[model samples]
Target: MKRVIQFATGNVGKHALPLIIERPGLELVGLHAHGPDKVGRDAADICGRSEPTGVIATKDIDALVALGADCVVYTSQAEMRPQQAIEEICRFLRAGTNVVGTSMVWLVAPQHADAWIREPLAAACAEGGTSLYINGVDPGYSGDSLVYTALTLAGRATGITVSEICDYGSYDDAEFTGVSFGFGTTPDHTPIMFAPGVLSSLWGGQVRSLADVLGVTLDEVRESHESWVTPEPIDCTMMSVAPGHVAAVRFAVEGIRDGQPVITMEHVNRLTPITAPDWPYPPDGRLGVHRVVVHGNPGVEINTRLGLDGVDHNDGGVISTAARAVNAIDAVCAAPSGLLSVKDLPAAHADRVMW
Candidate 1:
């Protein structure tokens, strides 16, 4: 069994902690709780399990590293604390601990990373003989891997578009909804997500990865976005939106090669489906869906939806994001020591994973 340690108890962590306990081939060794309330609590308790898993949560990073697990599922909040997260990931790698990450997704293709991330991650892996792989749902499988698989039938591609159509009313993130997304703010209020080079930093790596899969080198990667006004007050699951404020938005990051955009990643996000009447909606007129359009011979277009039995689309996304990393634990632990890309690993699925 692969020994596992989970850092932090957030949305993904809450799902991962208990999941690691139940998966047959994985052993839960420790939980690195981030908040004081979670520290000193039983791992199972932190994730709402009635019985104990014999693992306690601690805020002490060094102590957890000393336990020396086979892998660390690093899912801490990354958008705000990128440097700290990278440092923590390196520390774990240098201690001979492999890492499967849902945080700082740009690492999905370390080649797209700047020297600050790529250099240190490489050094740490070499120093301690470990590996690190980062992935998730939208930026993970749905971004590049799924596209690569779908392109199997293509002869030559003209253009490709991956669209994420999701309603954010049920996504419980106030910081993202209110400020980062400008959900309850005026048009002039630039959401950090829309700031210069922000969206590119987040998904450009995936764009480049897809380009590489298609055997093309990009001329440049560029971004474009537009936000709509609410025109009236509305309340979403996360926060309240005021009239005349930014309500919905559509954005794309394009990877250009040979003076044209060969690959594009787009997102259509609104507080609710009806909020942005002109923007694209899911194929089924639902809240959340991932759609891919491959513009080539024997063209392919498909929509994939993932949701929990009783949970909303947002919660299901969190669970899926966690699953992508957790299920890859054994593969990452078993790979050669280094910063691994999706290109370097085997098909990342667990046996009987659907069960």
Candidate 2:
């Protein structure tokens, strides 16, 4: 069994720990956390498991790097701190540890990663003969990989659009929903997601990746967005949304080729069902939906939803994101030494371990 470590115990990490423990061909070695509060705690405890695994969490980066594990599942949030996440992952890779996780969305297509970030990671991988792969629910499988897979069935593909349409009312993270996404913020307040080039920077890679797969060269990438305010005050799991505050948002990063949108990545995020009545709704009317449409000869549309075992769609999304990363560990370790993408890795399957 290959030894592996988890880099953080946050939302995604919490969901991943148990899967890593139960999966076949993997042995849990260590758990790494950022704050002193989490240091020295049992891995099982950090993941909310009653049983103990004997592995303790630590904040000592140098010591953790020296463990010489086969891989590190780096799931620390990168949306807010891209540079720090890149640096940390590079450190692990340079230590000859294969790295896989959902931290860097742009690295879902490694070639699309910024030069400054990609160059050092490539150098580190070359020096240590390790590999790194970045993936997640949206940017990884549901958005990029799944879209490409569906396109294969189409005889003549004219346009492709992938969307993450979900309600954020159940999301418990106020900072993320209210502040980051501007869910409960004023209409005039510009969230980072709507800032110039931010949407393109975060999701343009997915659009470009699809174009690359279809052998279509994009002339340029463009961005468009729209938002709505809550008509009445609504109390959500995370924060309260006052009337006239931002409640729903829709944005797209379009890959333009031949003066037309050939590839697009769009998000229709709402805090309430009534917020955006005119916007596109999920086919099944589920709380959360991921859809990919190929407007072509066959006119294919694929939809996916998750709300299993009383878990809300927002949290279900977190679990799916973590699972995608955890399942890819083995493939990443076996890949060629360098930054890898979903296209470079083999199919990831759940290796059920019979206890």
Candidate 3:
């Protein structure tokens, strides 16, 4: 069994560690937090202690490293800059400890993460002979891995696009609400994601990844975003949302490497109590529509939804996605050294390992 050490004590880690402990080839070791106050507390305390583990949380990176853990799963909510995430990943890779973590958004996306973060991480992993993986749902699963999965249905395809649409009405966390759905702000206040350089930063790597699989070179990439606010105010635990519920955010990336454009677009909407009006709730809550449209000689259109019938995926989505953040620990250790993506590793189902 792989000895696994957790570097976070929050909800993200809390949700994952329990399941990881039960996996046949894995053993839960200890928990570490960047916070001084959390040090010395039982790992179960951090997770509400519905069950108990003797492990205590600590802030000592070196001490944790000395544990000779086969893998480290970082779930901390630390606000370290992008470079810090790279540094931490490097530390584990150098220690011969494979790493899996949820630190940043779209770490593998060619358009969003800085080269400084990427290049060093790759170098460190290669030098240490360890694998490092970064993953989550949206940019991680939806943006890249799912794109790769969708292409499986195609033969001699020209282009493809995928989108997510849903109502985030029940989500009440102010911090998350503000950033994700763009509450208390106008569309202009949010970053213009589709601009030339901007487009490449978001999901351009997905286009690049697909191109690599298809043996094509992308000549250019472009992207854009759109959001709407409800006309009146409604109350949730987080904030009193005005304008009703926000409209959808439509973000698309167009890859033009082969004289024609291959586009991928995402539509995210918080359309529950009041959505676009025509959209219906998908049993789970509101709705999330992932649509893929391919245009060419034998064109095709496909759409799917993720959450199960009774599962409220809004909150569960973040936690479930975060759980998968640690799902690649074994693969990260066994694979050749370097930065790895979810699709890069051998197949593993996160649901089977949950606490």
Candidate 4:
């Protein structure tokens, strides 16, 4: 059985714990939390499981690393603290623990990483003979893996585009919805997402990954974005937005080859559905959807809807983000010592037998 430890008890990590506990081939050995409040708590209790797992959450990273687990699911937030996240990941890898999770979405394919980021991770993997794989909803399966899988049916591909159109009003993270995305902020205030090179830093790797799969070399990666403000005040699950405040955002990362975009990943995220009427909407009219369009011979357009048993769109995204990491544990643990990506690992499927 594969022994796994989870880092952090955030939304993704909390949703992923029970999955590890319930999976037949995995054992939950350690739970690591950063804050004092969560430390010393039962793993199951932290995740709200009815029964307790003997493992307790600890703030001791060294102790957790010494547990000799097969893998560490590093689900801590990476966007704001990228350098720190990379340092922590390198530390875990050098301590001989394989890692697979959502931190450092660009690390999904390490080859695309800059020299400063790539060298240390490479050295760590070499030192301890461990591996690291990172993924999530947008840069994860929904954008890269799923789009590549759908391309198999195409005869000749001219252009490819994948879009994640969703409403973020129900998302519970105030810092994320308010400060990061500028959801409740004024129209002129730029959020981190709109910061120069931030989008490219987070998503350019996925664009390049697709290009590699298609055997095309991109001349450059370009970004475009537009934002809309609420005409009237609106309250969301996370925070309240005043009139003439940032409400919706539409952005795209395009891979250009020979001065034309050959591949593009776009996102139309909003706090309310009525804000961006001109932008694309989910076909089924669900709160969330991931759509892929292949512009070529026998062009194909596919739409993926998420919302089950009355779950909200943002909650559904969190579950999927967690599952993407949880399902890849076995594959990552079995891989050779190095940074692994979707291209390096096989298509991971859910353990339906355990269901």
Candidate 5:
């Protein structure tokens, strides 16, 4: 069994806690809670597990690393604190611990990572002989590898687009919704998330990854976004929105090749499905919808929906991200040292589950 340490028991990390506990081949060695409120609590209580996992949450990173885990499932919001996250990851690798997570979307393509990051990350791996992987659902698997999966079935593909339409009405992170998304802010001051090059920074890796997988060199990645204000004061799951405040936003990051838009990654986020009536909605008129469209000789479209009768995915996006990280532990632990992406490892099959 591979000994594992779960880092950051936040929105995403909390979902991973139970999955790690459920996996028979993985042993939960340590838990790193993000805040003091969570520290010192039983892992089971933090994740709502009935039975005790016997692991207590700790805020001490050094102490957790000293556990000597085979792999660390990192789920911290690296985009918010990139430098700190990178330093911590290096410490883990240099201590001979592998890592897998969706923290830094840019690192999905290590070759495309910035020089400052690539150099030190390489050094850390060399020192401890460990590997690092960045994986997730949207920026991780859906927009890149999943897109590639559809592209392989196409005959003479011309262009590809991946669109994720999800209602954020129930997302519990107020800071992520109201503050970062500008849900209650005026359009005169657009959200920082839609600022110059921010969209590309968050998702350009997926576009670039697809370009590389297709053997096509991209000229650049372009960004465009639109935000709609609420007609009246409305209350959603995360927070309340005032009249004329931002409620819905549609954005895209397009990959340019040979002076043409070759690959596009788009997101349609809204406080509610009805907020953006003019914009794209769920294909089946549900809560969660992800579409992978390939423009080619015959054309291909793949739609994945959540919040159904039997399976409730309206609030499962974070869990999906966590699941991807947890499932990759073995592949990441066995791989060679240094920065690694999905291309570097073998197919990470789900243990005892269907392919």
Candidate 6:
């Protein structure tokens, strides 16, 4: 069995650990958290389980390394700060431990500036004879699997378009409901690009990656946002955000070559229900849906409601998305060194991440 150490005790890692530990060929040996009094806590309890294990969470890196696990699972927030995240990843690789996590945010850091991140990370893996990969549900799905699936339906396609529509108003997280979707806001409070930019950071490369696969030269990538605010309040219990929502978010991206559009992506998030009359097709009548359309001769479109009820934006959607990031540990470990994007790695289908 592959013995593993989870490097953080956050909700993501906690949710993924039980699944990992239950895998037939895997053993979850340790739970490491940076919280105070880190050691001797039950991993299951930390994840909100009633049953507790003797396994304690810890902040001692030396202890973790000495635990002699075959690999280390990192779900740390290093991704928020690109530079430091890369540095820490290098340390894990140099320590002769296989590493995996969400810190692969540097996947597309400009090749010219901070290009050193690539070479050194690659070298570290070689030096320690280790491997790493990083991916999340957004980049992993819309960027990798969904687009890849879309390409399979096309014949000599010249362009591809993928979109994810999420009604954030139905979301519960304060960061997402209030700050992300701009629930109660004036024109000056938040720009349209706020939530859309996050999507760009995660999936823009997917567009570029598809372009690379099709040998198309991309000239420009542009994004636009749309919003709606409820005139009055309504009562709802689906998400933790405010009741009777105030705002919603939707975004679109266009990829062009020589001023000609070739690829596109759109994401929509709203607290209240929505219908897109402008879309060439009918809206899925669900709170959220991931839609991928490949533009070539006889274009093909694929749509799936990935939320709570195939149309509802429930905690299940957020939890599942976050779980995808941690459950992808082994795939990331198998990927080639250096920062990796969803397109950089293979489908995360391993006994290790199956929860």
Task: Give TM-scores for every candidate, taking all chains together and pairing residue i with residue i.
Answer: 0.96, 0.96, 0.83, 0.96, 0.95, 0.79
Going through the candidates in order, what is the number of backbone clashes in each? 0, 0, 14, 0, 1, 16
**Which consecutive 10 residues in model 3 have the weakest lDDT in total?**
278-287
Q: Which residues of candidate 2, in runs, are more than 4 Å off?
A: 353-355
For model 2, how does the per-residue alpha-carbon lDDT over 1-355 read when each residue is reduced to its tens digit? Answer: 8899999988889888888887878889989998788888999888878989999999888888999999999888887887888888888888999999898787888898789878988998998899998888887787766786787889999999888999888887777546877888898999988999988888888778778778999999999998899889988786788898988899999999889998888899888687788998877668889888999898999888877778888888989888888888878888899988887876544455344
lDDT of 6 by residue, 1-355 (tens): 6678887755456556666555566577777787775556778777766767566787777777777666777767654466766676677777777776644544532221135556777777788777766555554466557777878877867667677666554554554235545656653556433644665664566666667767887887766666655555533432333333445556666778988768887766555553233333327556666777877767788876554434444555545655565555666566665555555556545444433
**Candidate 4: where are CA atoms >4 Å away?**
348-353
Quick one: RMSD of model 5?
1.7
What overall lDDT goes with each candidate model?
A: 0.84, 0.85, 0.64, 0.85, 0.83, 0.61
Residues 29-140 of candidate 1: C-alpha lDDT, one tens digit per residue? 9889877898888988888889988788888899989989999999988868888988888888999999998888778778888788789889999999999999888787
TM-score of 5: 0.95
The segments of candidate 1 whose C-alpha lies over 4 angstroms from its true place after superposition are 352-355
lDDT tens digits by residue: candidate 4, 197-301: 978877888888888888999999999888888899878787788888888888999999999999998899888777778888777668789888999999988
Tell me how far the alpha carbon of residue 266 in candidate 5 is from the true structure, in angstroms, after superposition.
Answer: 0.7
- Candidate 4 displacement at residue 74 in angstroms: 0.5
Off by over 4 Å in 3: 34-38, 77-80, 109-113, 191-199, 244-248, 257-260, 271-273, 276-286, 289-304, 348-355
- Give a tens-digit lDDT track for model 3, residues 27-88: 77867776677778777766665666788788778888778788888766533355666676
Residues 252-343, candidate 5, lDDT per residue (tens digit)?
Answer: 99999888898999988888766878988876557778789999878989887644556556467787788888888888787878788888
Rate residue 187 of model 1 by lDDT: 83
Question: Clashes in candidate 6: how many?
Answer: 16
The candidate, 5 or 6, that scores higher on TM-score is 5
Judged by whole-model lDDT over C-alpha atoms, candidate 3 comes out at 0.64
Note the residue pairs that clash in candidate 2. none
